[model samples]
Target chain A: MSIKQEELEEIYAFAVQLGKDAGAILLERAQERFDGSKQAEQGHIEKVNAVDLVTQTDEDVEAFIKSKITKQYPSHKFIGEETYSRGVSRDYLIDDEPTWCIDPLDGTVNYMHLFPMFCVSIGFIVNGKPVIGVIHAPFLNQLFSSCSGKGAWLNESQKMPLTRNPTPPLPPNAPSGCVFSCEWGKDRRDQPDSNLHRKVESFFNMASEIGGREGKGGMVHGVRSLGSATLDLAYVAMGAFDIWWEGGCWEWDVAAGIAILKEAGGLITTANPPADPATAAIEEVKLGSRLYLAIRPAGPSANETGRQSQERTVREVWRRVRHLDYSRPGV
Target chain B: MSIKQEELEEIYAFAVQLGKDAGAILLERAQERFDGSKQAEQGHIEKVNAVDLVTQTDEDVEAFIKSKITKQYPSHKFIGEETYSRGVSRDYLIDDEPTWCIDPLDGTVNYMHLFPMFCVSIGFIVNGKPVIGVIHAPFLNQLFSSCSGKGAWLNESQKMPLTRNPTPPLPPNAPSGCVFSCEWGKDRRDQPDSNLHRKVESFFNMASEIGGREGKGGMVHGVRSLGSATLDLAYVAMGAFDIWWEGGCWEWDVAAGIAILKEAGGLITTANPPADPATAAIEEVKLGSRLYLAIRPAGPSANETGRQSQERTVREVWRRVRHLDYSRPGV
Candidate 1:
């Protein structure tokens, strides 16, 4: 479904407001924790599973966002990580109504460890497609927002205007160097057909190929794993980092980021076959596709060179990595 | 060989001023290159041999510092990275006089790459030992300083009292985690003994044990190769990371950081056999003794546990790494 420009603007502003509200709550909670862990409390939030974590802060933040959105726009649907985990249907495309997808706290692991890399992400999905996104990182003091057509922006200042050095109608080139973000997901004890190992090896091989043996031949400049998908995508939008790839993250992790990236002249696709946005709905994007690639705009003169370099590096990487049978249920 | 405290203070203040001044200059130069390759006219910085890196900036900064100090007190000695590299004998003996040791730019690689991790390091060595240190990272707006008796500090605030926590230090108990930093250096040719290859393999083995075996206990939290020694040393002081082992870096690369880390109750020794400060003179610290290990603070309660864990891990790492012959001059 095509979203009108005015509708996109409205959604973008709503997403930004929701994100800032959630971000403020997160900041307040983070400040309270600065005095250090206040006694080991055991509750649903603290003791979710044997090892996995879901702090009270996460629940409160997520619930607060849901309530705010519902109160402001009662007809709009909402899906959040915390709510979804508690038996909410994963089917995000149940209706054509605009649904808000949120990850109150992305980089939960970093938050659990007090690593200071977490952020609040809010995405507005219209008819099963994300068209407006906002990501706020209180600690880093950065707010990234994007509407489908109005273009992506950082802190409401710099508009990431698409430029082809000489002016466009020119095919976009691959980035000079790409930065991919990888994370060791929850289930370290469970190895599904060496999926984890293949992912790790693929990262090393791909990085080496792109960066060259010592950063020479590879089309990519370098790679950085900052432990947060939201921040990685934001960095890609800001031109601080060129590309970000990942697997095993939930929709909540990338929904907001995907929208922001798209608006910033960045491309997101399944690492296997390139993603066809026309066919794939936002919520239908699967993690077990086991591959995700985000590429930034290349210069006019070197666009083709950059694309060919990236394609060659990715293919080389795929050839070396053993295919995992993630086709299994619950992998 | 014992120097007067008044003289040391003068040197410390001098170094701090110089570092801040140089860092500001570096930041300005870096900002100028943000839009395009500002250095294209002069060719790549790396194209010049390592020794030639004592550029006009370095020389100018050093001269500015030296002139100020000499004008005030002609008896005081100055030992800067550029000056020492030219002809000054590598000697750290106190000899009853105060000496200022400075690295105008630490993490030159990061500076060249525009990574924003490099810094200016300055230390006042008395009687062959560092008594005062200051490290300034202009871009990050962080200044780390420490006087032997006054305790370490960040930006003249948040004093880092040299107290070891009784609990087991975070490193060893830190589930198989390590971060290593290495430079590609000047030698890029594919040789069996290539330092880059050895460093890379060491990092890989530590992070993911040899042969990709899981239960073998070689896996680490992750590895990071941030190209800055002074910043790496400061990180060790901050407890953000565990161990930072590196080779092929020189005295200028670590001198000031070593002082700061020691003041913060951390440890720095030759990566091989762990040099004892009691016997090793300041001048005895050689570039050839490039193998270095910077370990975070471990308290009495956690000392044994941390030592055992680190010892085992390092030994296991040693088994996988090829022993380098530092006996070869100027490795």
Candidate 2:
């Protein structure tokens, strides 16, 4: 079910080209002002809806990628945000056919704001498992890629090959620092759950704990919400954040990032308990079942400490949340 | 006490050169790692203490600036962070001699972490009032400058022109947005007052008002703490933020920013009272004692709306802040 080394190299090269192409187009279009009135007229107001934002740009890019993949390997399958939005689903059982998942823009909000943080993410799934991934942030001149069994890498730099070298890792029981990234999803005012209050309260509590009374027990360096999922994942890959937790983002928001983290010896899963009982049964034991805990490649013995640190921080954050009801089962 | 156009121009040019020069030096030296052992050996365990962080680099930069100013204009007086750290009083009374106030590194913690949100702030105090200010964020390639009688500018681009050509003034009743920037400061633990906690809580309440938030009220874009006071002020000048409320920062932290904001038709004052009491005694209400409220250029009609928005937001925030003692107050 694993991808061959030669195939990984090919996928990496293809993804790099695709990412650059999309990045170039975005940069060019960003320089000019679109007719604000036209945008307002074109149903852009519905963009805040969790399920309604599939812009023409998204479809065009997905179509472009599909065409390229079909021409090169007609038998391969494709999974994309636009296609998924249209109710496409695939059985991710171990298989020989390669499955390509793509998110044309990981930070759509940032792109809309012209904030320069969005990026192209591509992942290769083989035998129902992600085996390779590539993410490109062209404006920032950063490219990250990795393949299963091979160490991850940044741009073509080998100095700090995405793998951790043998070094004494910080103790797991040791206090940890964290940077949590969250987005203000569209439904701030009228939602059934009203997750906004809970999210904000959690952020405040965690920040206060780390910056404790005179910042004593506050072992955290700081918390940052850069408003980009791709950049947040990349930061985890770079050891800039100890943990990244989130809920409600779609699979497209995380598919490629999951691959990147895995190849870098990280983990990922659903933030909430799975609706499917089978998935939940297995998730209870494996760290990977929990939503995106990308512990940077620590020394072999340091993994325990990293895991403990992550658990402690999350627990402390949960305790300090004041206004929200966290007792509604598991999320 | 007002500076002439020509003098302002000369000061602006000098400031630009010095800022760029110091920025370049900082970038070069920042790559070298300091001996952690030495820092620990200095008995400077006040790791989170605001005052105990007087590194040699700060002194070196201050000395460099002082010497440069003294050599270029022997009559000008110099005020800097390092000198002020050595037991200087906060009084900045007016004097016949021109005065320069400088903060070598505005976001020292960020600098220590290799984060790119720090800057060099240089301001000119003329007769006890800020007349010219230049804030350079070399890493981000941003430069904000302004002179008395002239408008504020960003990276040579005229953002708020000194002389308004015929556009309607900003509406007085326009709702205002704010960006509250602050640090945890040195006292994370015990103190007579938890000013930071109160300030942050207040900001949250104002930004995210409770139920029935009306008339574009409680609809702040979001809060951003980029870890640099100079950058925060620059953003205010650029209209990126409607209000910037901060505490625990010193004169050096804000001197340059005050000049820039003034030039941009903004206001500044302590966040204690509704009006500057010192200025209340003055015949000219416009020339009241300064505290720190850098407002954007608003049309005559806009003043009422702006004031209303400010008061409502501030009061709402004060209502939510519980930990701090706000009994003693004066803006």
User: What DockQ, between 0 and 1, does each candidate earn?
Assistant: 0.16, 0.15
Quality of candidate 1's docking, in CAPRI categories?
incorrect
Q: Score every model by TM-score.
A: 0.74, 0.71
For model 1 chain A, the run of ten residues with the poorest summed lDDT? A164-173
RMSD of each candidate? 6.5, 6.9
Q: For residues A75-112, what per-residue lDDT tens digits would candidate 1 score against the true structure?
A: 78888888887874544332457788889998665554
Runs in model 2 lying further than 4 Å from the true structure: A34-43, A48-100, A106-194, A209-219, A256-290, A293-331, B1-3, B33-59, B88-97, B127-132, B141-193, B206-219, B239-243, B258-331
Error of 1 at A232 (Å): 2.7
Best by lDDT: 1
Candidate 2's interface RMSD, please? 7.4
For each candidate, the alpha-carbon lDDT, in order, equals: 0.58, 0.55
**Candidate 2 local Cα displacement, residue A279, angstroms:** 21
